[model samples]
Target chain A: MAGEREQPAEPLTLRRVAASHAAARVVVSASFEVAAGEIVGLAGPNGCGKSTLLRTVAGLHPCERGEVVLPRSRTPAGVARVALVPQGYAQSFWPWASLRSGIALAASGSGRGWYRSAAARAQSLRAELALDLDLGLRPYQCSGGMLQQAALLRALAAFASGPEVLLADEPFSALDVDVARRARAALRRFVRERGVRALVVLHDVESLVETCDRVLVIDGKPWSTDGASEGVSTARMVLNARLGSRRPDGDADAAAPTTSSFGDAMARVLGAGPHP
Target chain B: MTKGSAGRLALAAATFAAGLALWLALARSGWIGRTLLADPIDVARALAGAFDPAAPPGARVLVHAEATLVRALAGWVIALLVGMGCGVALGARAWAYVLGEPLFELARAVPPILAFPLLLVAFDFGEPAYVGTIVLGCVPIVAITVARGRLGASRERSELLAVFGVPRSVRALTAIMEVMPSCFLAARLALSTSLVIAVVTEMVFTPRSGIALGALAKEAQMSFETDVYFAVVVVVGLFGYAANVVLRAVERRLGLERSTST
Candidate 1:
């Protein structure tokens, strides 16, 4: 009941996953599943270990207990490849590289088949998403929204090289309403088209319910529990939004519940007393 | 030039003029004796004489500058490369950083100029000592700063690189790119310090049969030829300033001039 243990299609799986930061056990035994074609939303209060969980699944951080069971069967590289778009876009990007070069860097693969195709794919994604951007500018030259867009572009470019599990940490929090809508649309289209999964962290509950197929709510111990032992995660899959059968064009139409209904559901889950 | 640049230039001119006025007042009032502070006009004449072409070649500022530049540049360039190489190598692994830190600290404990006497004894008070001292003075800073550059990059950026699985060569290049600001700082510090160290080396060792700028200043000062001493000082300052200008221009061309340090 903790996860879809019966399903074996090999979507990104974290079984008994525990992650920590700077010696403080943050994710205390988190178990969840992100199935193919799923745009799973991770929602939680601040310091609830959402980012740490994403980072651990992406193979960027160390896992204390339990294993992250990455799907290698469906990947182009015959191994799990994850692209993490972290919260700090500016710091992750190579300050010295131009936007075009940064995208190209992400597009690169070990072998020749999918390496350095960022320009073409970026052009196509840009057109599909209706994004207006200049690839010649550096990260510092771009605004916050622009940089976030660039970070998204880089992750997607990496995804193009193979079937990548997209782990984005508040990837579009800085974008304006219009851009955010279009970007979400493009992300949904990409996941559905390629049958890949994405685990996107979102602080906005409305966006979480309206966009994600399933929402995983992260809950954790109080900050004072520094020595909280090996029991790592307290995350749960609480909501299945009637938000989509989700639209690929940012519309809240198909099988969509009322805005008030979705808001109440999110409120109930978020306002729940505490994870026992 | 832009308005800001023009304003800066005007301010620099005003400051220079003020310094000249203060120097003239001090000389006239005999507060700082002429033996200690040469008359500006006399210093200008001495400078002109050093470059007059009619003057003996041995006294020519060009000859001394050329000799010192070659010696100092040889050591500086070598040290820069060595430092960068060490930094890149050590920065690639945390264990390497831990292992190399002690050596870097030891190198830092002794300033490069202080090594001159040891080098002087080792090289029998010759040209090799100056070269050796200049290299010693600069390597530790360049290496330590370059090594630390890799550590300062945000984890998000590093995760991107890792997820993409960029080639080893690209990773090396990224390592280099992350540290450009530190590299520039290292370069600027090394360039400015090497010249001063070179001057000190010459004054202490006084090349037996060659043109050494610091030796000329030392000889002038010992004999109370304040004008000539000031002239050499001006030339040494000019050399340091020009090197900085050249370095700044290179960094600007690379578009790394405003890059943030680690």
Candidate 2:
């Protein structure tokens, strides 16, 4: 009878999350959920609380009033299952630590055996990304592109031991077109192969269109668009519409068209244009 | 040797040679008294005499030197632990910084030596007094330097750690590690100051608990044993210099020197 008892499933959920700073509340009563094997993207302008929302979800920033529920693993062993790849990969990786040591620390924190499992994951990721450098190099020795790739690899190695969700905050900001595209492709393949849920924050609409299955636009709040490669147009339209309603002046129309053009170009890029 | 090390050694040798030449010229001209300032050879002889097996010099110099080292190290370690902790706490909390800034500044502005009389009254002439003098002298310097270094750590690094859901202890460790080179530099400087304070306190207080090199030097001065006094001064100087060199080596091994040099 005990063996026959059914076990409950694990889910990562956020409810009514709100964040405030010095009388300015950026994210108010926003909620989102990511099931296993799903990739969600949060896209918005620079001060749109995308990063704040991710931080709250990852349990990095405390919500003023909200709940983040990370369901326990089904196995007898309990684990708080979440990893985050922060923005500015160069800054995230410890400059003093070698790539191997840094990745090992990250992996060890998750209670995973870092020597064998984590090393294999790192080597696989390096091979996946086609990185020429060995694991012993320090962060400062690597270029921005290399560091970004290594940061992603570190996150992957940490999360590889079991089925766990990941939060990546602006993984490809300030990168040139070629590297950004490469990173996006690498992330997509890694996520697909691992079958892990992720919420990636993106500043550029085009990157979300290419990498994310579903896009959630956060201006002052959260809004979700349909899941499709072509849905980027829909997401952009919603962004402009929200921006226009907030502005309401004649400048709204002028700004709307420029943003729309930019979004459209982004959509085309995401839709299958050559790497810029 | 690396080109950089070679250059530094050459510069050091050149400066030493020039200083030696000046000392020789001065001694030959007899402008400065030989008793007051011995020639290089005479100073060397005095150094040899101080440690010579045949003469069997008094244990006073060794005892005083050991005492000074013990007091300085004890005070330095205590100051480092307490000061760095307070610095991290203040750096993490803005209100703490606001509340503690004025007190810290006032305490730092007052030199440790100036408090020797008050400490003497409280702790009396003994080990406690000497240690108190050193701690009172060194803690504020350590605190100010560490606090400043902590404050100067990159905000982006904090945000990055926060975004990763890192616990508070992990965040603090990372932040401290990020700024450790700066803290180490401050500690090195504080070490030199601690030695100076240790000597000054021993000299001023003249504690009867044990032999003190400063007190011995003072006695030599009164007795006009200039060679012995100068020899003791050179020993203290060598100790300080050696300590600094050791710390510099540690800094290099920690990779702080590379970033600093570049």
Candidate 3:
């Protein structure tokens, strides 16, 4: 007889979460839940609080009215449950710290020992991401694309020590097309291997469709927009349309019906097609 | 060595030779009075005499150099501590930065020499007045440079730390570590200013001991020993150069400049 797999209880839950910067609201009120082993893409135009929403979920930004509940693992007392790959390589890591030092510090912060094995993990992840750079190099010495890869590696190192959810804000925005494709594949593989849930904020629509299990759209700046419109329900509708009409490997086949279907779905939610 | 480095070394030597040649020509020409502008040979002799213990009673050049160095170094260390402390405090809090900025700006503009009279009255021509002059000259530059560097630290980096639940103490320490490169660069500037202020303070407010190169220069001027005055000035220039060389080595050893873009 085959053994039944156990499912995790709500890995991440956001209830009526609202964030603002001194009266100018960003994420008005967003309520959503991400199940374990799920990849959710947050799509929106520039300045529409996609980054803000991710930050709020990551607990970096304080939610004014609502609550963000992150599921805790059994051990590791003080480590955070959510890991973030912040946007922009230049803004992500300390310029003075070598790639190894920064990742070691992050791993140590996540309740893992800063040991040789941790460094070996980081070295392998750097290779897996096709970074092809020495771990001893500082962020300043690396090119923009290389730095972005390093940032992803650091996020993975943090995630290695049992962070339930990964919050990635524009992780691949700085990469070239070929590198982006490789990064997307690596991200998918890494997340699957760890069985971690992720909420990725992306402007590139194709990668979103390729990598994410479900897609969520936030219309016009969430915080300042007057009426408290339906947030999670609208995302649910898009997700349903995306899943019901499309196959998981639709992006691989150029003529797959789901590609056009996904594009059309995005057109309605994003006020434009995938290119936007 | 690489060709570029070799060329650079040659060019530097050439420039120094050219400057010395020009100085010699001017001194030999006697266009200016010899008493006012000493010849290079006489200046060299005076420099040698300065280090000789038996040259004169109460006129050993080492004594003046030591006194000036002690005062300037004390002032520089104080500036380093105060500047970094105030800069971290101001950078950490937005309100404190806003409140402190204008006061720092105003204080920075007032020349240290102009404050000497006030310092003299406050400390009565003592060591306090001399050290205060050096601090006033140096502290503002160091503090402002450090504060700006601290403030310009990337918010995304801070958010990265926050996401991993790094403790606030670690975050603060990391912030300081990042700012150190710029701080050392500022220290070079502060050090030069402290040297200038130390010498000027010694010159303007004559100490009762009269044990400073600037005081020795004043005495040399009165006695018409123009070569001795010029030698003392050369020593002061060399002191500044030595301090800068030390700072550059430190920056290299720490790899601070190597790691930073600017």
Winner of 1 and 3 under TM-score: 3
Error of 3 at A62 (Å): 2.3
Most accurate candidate by lDDT:
3
RMSD of 2: 8.1
lDDT of 3 by residue, B1-262 (tens): 7797588679968987897789889999989888988898989887787678776645677678889889999999999888878777776667878888887788889998998889888997788888888888788888887887777777777777777777787788777777887688889989989988888888887877888887888888899999888888888888898888789868866667653562
Better of 1 and 2 by TM-score: 1
Over 4 Å off, model 3: A1-9, A78-80, A223-276, B1-15, B29-36, B121-124, B258-262
Task: Using TM-score, rank the candidates from best to worst.
Answer: 3, 1, 2
iRMSD per prediction, in order = 2.7, 4.1, 2.4
lDDT of 3 by residue, A1-276 (tens): 101334345667778777765466767677677777677788756776778778788877778877888876644573336677887556676666788887766665543355455577788777867766688987777788777777778878764444568888888888888888888887876666565788899877677766776666544554322233544322211222232234344332121112234445565543332321
Q: Between prediction 1 and prediction 2, which has the larger DockQ?
A: 1
Local lDDT at A40 for model 3? 74
True-vs-predicted CA distance for residue B176, candidate 2, Å: 6.9
Q: Over the stretch A56-104, how does candidate 2's per-residue lDDT look in tens digits?
A: 7776677877687776664345655567777756666665567786665
lDDT tens readout by residue for model 1, A1-276: 213223336688777777788787766666667887788887766876778888888777898778888777544547766777778887766666678777877766545654446677776676767777887887778888988898888777665533458888998798899998888877877777665678989988656754577666543332111123343233222332334323344333222121233334564643322222
- TM-score (0 to 1) of chain B for each candidate: 0.88, 0.86, 0.88
